[model samples]
Target: MCQTLRQKHNLTVRRQDVMLMMADLDPVGIEQRSRRRFVRRVYHSLGPNHVWHVDGYDKLKPYGLAISGCIDGYSRKVMWLVCGASNNDPDIIAHHYLQCASEFGVIPKLLRTDCGTENGTMAAIHCSLRSTHTDDLAGASSHMYGSSVTNQRIESWWSYFRKQNVLQKDLDECKEIWNTHTIRAVNQSRCPSGKPDAMYALPHRFNGRECGFCISQENLNEFFVELTRSTCGDGQLQAHFEELHAQSNLTTSYTWEAGVENYITLKNMAHI
Candidate 1:
């Protein structure tokens, strides 16, 4: 509420003020929200990059597109948001993981995800990458699989993403938005309150340490070679959109409405 006021109205209102207004303007909502019960779950994280929750948002899948993303558990920063042909494809998912990790030159100490077949390749890749890391969660146990409901960070993101009716179709543009969204601080909780990017970049400011481990390009290359060798005989999903994108003469970003239009344009071109 405070953030909304500040951003939309350029007014920095107090939390108490917002509460009072919400009570008067939306009594039923406030009452219902107050009565909501939260199930107890004991979850802890060291800091940013300590654990990344990876998941797919399937609500838009019926439109012949898919959205998959990963969020840092501690800082609540979205590490990656990818819009593509199929979030279920292992190679595409793995590519998003590797590309995002490459941007930071490091991977999370641990990765939390739901037990989905689509996550198989990403799971194997994370474990393989963590082979030489000395963390407590390294090696075979580096990836933790759980139910979607319990994969809190990314799941929570999907909820908010839907609530906002995020119509921006450019994955990177959408990524920039929620990545900077402010998370309200809970009273008596140790979680920091601020924009995710700030907390992720400067964890020490919030009394947290950077928990990601640096990885070498050679390791990534070796794994890619193995991935290629293993899929040699199988039908592979090439990055056709990328090939089309280069020749499409389109800007790299688009609103959700614009993206749909541009997607059709590229799809037809690819078919041709």
Candidate 2:
């Protein structure tokens, strides 16, 4: 509310002031929970792209849909969020991640995720990339870290997502909205562009580091092809994966015309 007032309305009200107004609007709902909870602890990261918290939200698993996303540790900006029927598939997860990296033009220095198979393919590539840096100055560390509670940055956003999206919504539309949504800076300082798009592109506004590092197209293609073979057959799925890589622009949409229905049906049945 404070961010909206500052960015959209050009008002100068403080966040505490907005909270007071909201409490007055709903006195009962504004009361704090009486239940005991863990003491709030804060974690810090060096800057944007230094660490990313990635996880899958499976509340829509029964409906053959799930969401996977990454959020920057320092800026609290979402790197990318993808909703799909094949969210459980390692290759699909890896593809969405690579596509995000391609669009942003750099993969993060570290990726933090729970120990899930969905992250297996991407984790392997991150490991291989780090291994290439035998020299002391390479400074390539493990891309993935395993701790769900430690990933509260992105985890906290899920609660609000659940509240706002009470019904089924368009996946692409949800992605667009999340990407453009404005957020308050860590210090609650007003940023000219509070939206994630601006925060990520202009991290300097928050005195954060700029995104640095670009992955080559060839390496991306190799990783996907290798991951595809490990997860599925060398037939239709492989062809579709290659076609995605061949596109001049990585954002081009491609559907698994051959096997998506069956895959989704089987996945949904497993949950049932």
Candidate 3:
């Protein structure tokens, strides 16, 4: 009778429901508590540009591609995706970074990556960026100069991508198909929190115009400076400001100063 019931009336369980049932069965209760704690930790660490997660994938044969993926920790958008063999090459990572900046027009404030050989080679790209090593009391300056931010959001995204998309059959054709489908799905899908989609603009009711507007340089500068100086200190925001200053060919001090000046000028001009 039990066997017949098990076979005929088996539960169609969702992942969360299974987890809840398991928690109810756990004798010590530690498993459920620990899992909850772990999830909360992950949620607390997420922020836009807070961390970038990267890994290499080789499940697809013949081509044997190595992939590095970057995700926006806050918006959960895939910021950068690059595929190539030779896991340890910095060029691959750099190429992806450039592609992201060109397409998205934003630079990540913090890059979170695993301790891979390619990611470990900080010298080449560090020199290219012209960021000087400071002799602060900290250990080797390399540690201070190179990308140091780390988080688990990227890892979670990787697990979802692997199980839901990458690890499916048809390994040969999965890359192109998965990339196109996943990106489109993510860009269009609404977040569970009811937040607006990050990739596209919201529709303005008055004019039916897309609400997305290019952030003016003057406003951007002021916003970043205020972010840096404000009490809600975020490392990712600081990193973004630095990256933008570098890209704009302005010194860090000059960037902040100019931003303030520009904001004032714009406001004054508006008054006229």
Candidate 4:
């Protein structure tokens, strides 16, 4: 309305003034929450891949699908969104993290998440990367890993996810839709092309925040081997492990026994 008035009527009005005028015109129509006043807060990150926020959404539980996703802290690019039958399953969460790292050469320096049990596998994977985990307390419903206000970047996307009315469809299709959909740059650091995938590839456009950390091929193989152990049988996993190492030219110095021990240690420490 402010822009329309300025463009059409040679009238200048501030956006907040226009909002107040609208509120007076239809007081009941205005949301009470919107009317509340608070100091505006700003959030910033050092750079992309410096931190990532990962979480799961289970609103589609009645339809038997749950969504897990990660978003870069700085550029606000969504790293990946993975869907499965159970978002709470540790393996499902770990698989999505692994998949994101596979596509992007670097791993995040830090991951922030709530202390829900669903994050167990993701936390384990983050620790495996020698990355730090910043967590909200377990069962602390009011606490968010970072401030609730700061975490709004991805949480706001969930609102649009429901508005699109795509929740009832199959998981794979929903994942595809989200991955391809273009988001315009609301800030300067966002992709010039306004697509997450494009911005992800062109880090220079966002001030050189891309590909900061690369996981070794041997470590990648070990991670998947540990990840696939119970999920897939020994023969199939062995073949995959060897293939990954050979493809990446990584020396296979880490043993499966050591991987198991590392996983167990991380899991136990995560709870305490």
Candidate 5:
């Protein structure tokens, strides 16, 4: 609070004063109870893209909407956050990973995700690409799977997600806020406190390094071909989805409300 005021308004108030004012303004938030946990896990990451944590947020699943995301373990930058119809689908989740890698033109040295069946396709793709390299984190070792709760970085972030909002637009706006917001330093932690996007873009500024690996253009193309086959049902499903979209009267301009409305309409039409 103090830093934000100083940076934006050129005000120099003590931290305590700012805290008190904020407390009065948001008493419920200030008095919010902390969740009790058994352990405080201390983790280490070599740098941005050293490890990418991927997970599914299911709070909206009951509404026929799904959210999937990936975060940088080192800088806590949200690599991607997407809302879709079925996060449990292997191809859908894999598409998220592939899309992110293509956009950034790089993949993490290692990927971490829970051992859910939905991650099977993503794991295969990561290993297949990493196999081209001869690094220690290549091949089948490119991804790790374990319990979802143990994927602490993204797990904790989901709690904040629950408190804030629940839509694709909300998720996108929240992701922007998260990337630009300053993080507070914690004791015994090597990760520096700073805006996530800045830390990721300039790792050296925070005594960190980049561990991203470049993707070969040929492999990227081939993978896209394979992904289309797996996810698009050989173009028939793609055409059918387009028909449904048109029937639902949805435009390219999307919102959570409209998406749910479309889903419900389709469900009713399908007699499901």
Candidate 6:
């Protein structure tokens, strides 16, 4: 049916497009029911601050290393990536989150991870959340607010990234070099379309100016704080934190001790 439609309309009918067309063609009552279900599922998946998706990939190698990565949904940024010999634990995953939090001065409200042994373990998830200062604050804010998980977005990104960077069949040949180069390249590259809405507008409406590559960390923090306070509340600078806190699952004033510790450590190292 999709092939026929594509031929008739001179359109490339992808799976999702075909699904949408089918839903539209369904009986009115059925369409409504399906739409409701879809909406419910989507709403349930997004938390307020940021939703992170983590996954591990087995490298093609005699080296036998595994690579893990976490991506932020809103900014479409690669938060963290680590390569290690063992894929049996969540230490790398937790460390990745810590790195992201320190870099951005914000914590993810919900984390979406695959149902693998390393990711799905109760101990891993608990430790991942409990060990971080940002997580503690995120938990408190969530308790005073609300939060959710959306795994579909991260899964979609994974598919796209694999297709673009790692879909080669000859994984054993140039895999190590390719993996390292590709990961680094992807991180440094800017999205061709530019940032969503371009937080800063052009000086003149008609005149074309190239958008800047990055915003300073201080400015970014200020922008985020203002956005959070305006959108959520003065008390909680993160919407997801507030959402989860409202649900009584998180606290409101947890310490960011880990963040502080890392910052001090980095400063000292820089001095040396």
Candidate 3: tens digits of C-alpha lDDT, residues 149-268? 334555655555564333223232333233222132232223212122332222232122321112233422322211122211346654654454455543322232454564355445
* Clashes (candidate 6): 23
**lDDT per residue as tens, model 4, 68-126:** 77777665577777655566767777777777777776777667776677676667766
lDDT of 6: 0.41
Query: Residue 145 of candidate 4: its Cα lDDT?
Result: 58
Shift of residue 157 alpha carbon in model 6, Å: 1.7
* Span of 10 residues, lowest total lDDT, candidate 1: 229-238
Tens-place lDDT per residue, model 5, 163-198, is 656677778877877887788887535788899999
Q: After superposition on all CA atoms, how large is the RMSD of candidate 3?
A: 22.4
| Model 2 vs truth, CA RMSD | 8.8
lDDT of 6 by residue, 69-129 (tens): 6654433445555554445455445544444555755545555665565654323333334
Please say which candidate is ahead in lDDT: 1 or 2.
1
**Whole-model lDDT values for every prediction:** 0.77, 0.63, 0.40, 0.58, 0.81, 0.41
18-70 per-residue lDDT for model 1 (tens digits)? 88998999999888878747755545677899999999988887875577889
- Residues 153-223, candidate 2, lDDT per residue (tens digit)? 77876765665442224444444465576664433222233676666677877667754456777767667
Model 5 per-residue lDDT at 68? 96
Between candidates 4 and 5, the one scoring higher on lDDT is 5
Give the candidate order by descending TM-score.
Answer: 5, 1, 2, 4, 3, 6
Of models 1 and 3, which has the larger lDDT? 1
**Candidate 4, position 13, lDDT:** 80
Q: Which regions of candidate 6 are displaced past 4 Å?
A: 1-48, 59-65, 120-150, 164-272
- By the TM-score metric, which is better: model 4 or model 6? 4
> Which parts of model 1 are misplaced by more than 4 Å?
1-26, 165-171, 187-189, 224-253, 257-272
Worst 10-residue stretch by lDDT in candidate 6?
223-232
